[model samples]
Target: MKKSILKWCMLAFLLISNLAVFAQGGTEDTPEPGDGTEPIDSKLIWLAIIGIAFAFLYFANKRKAVRA
Candidate 1:
């Protein structure tokens, strides 16, 4: 019972700190990537490729485990 109460107190503390940070707003050094830089679409394509590769590897391993 004591442990559960401590866990909840910790969770509430974390939530309150997160809310405080959000209320402050705009913590970043640079305005979010819109200042005449190269477009992000190419970077997004690379990210998609990386995601697909990981998914393919995951399924391949699963298939091998099933076969074994």
Candidate 2:
């Protein structure tokens, strides 16, 4: 039980730690990637990729659970 709790705590810490860096990135005055006129924004693409990866992990785990 302690090991399972520790594992979840570590996962939560890693996720929160990574997101904390994003919170430091931009202010309302300046914004990220400079002005609003940029043709391409990589952030959206990266967000989508992360979403897909999370979905994949969720589905894979769900399948394992269903089989067992």
Point to the candidate with the largest lDDT.
Answer: 1
What lDDT does candidate 1 reach at residue 36?
73
lDDT of 2 at 60: 100
What lDDT, from 0 to 1, does candidate 1 have? 0.87
Cα-based lDDT for every prediction = 0.87, 0.84
lDDT string for model 2 (1-68, tens) is 99999999999999999898767544466446756745456578988999999999999999999999
The C-alpha RMSD in Å for every predicted model, in order, reads 7.4, 6.1
TM-score of each: 0.43, 0.41
User: Per-residue lDDT tens digits of candidate 1, residues 45-67?
Assistant: 89999999999999999999999
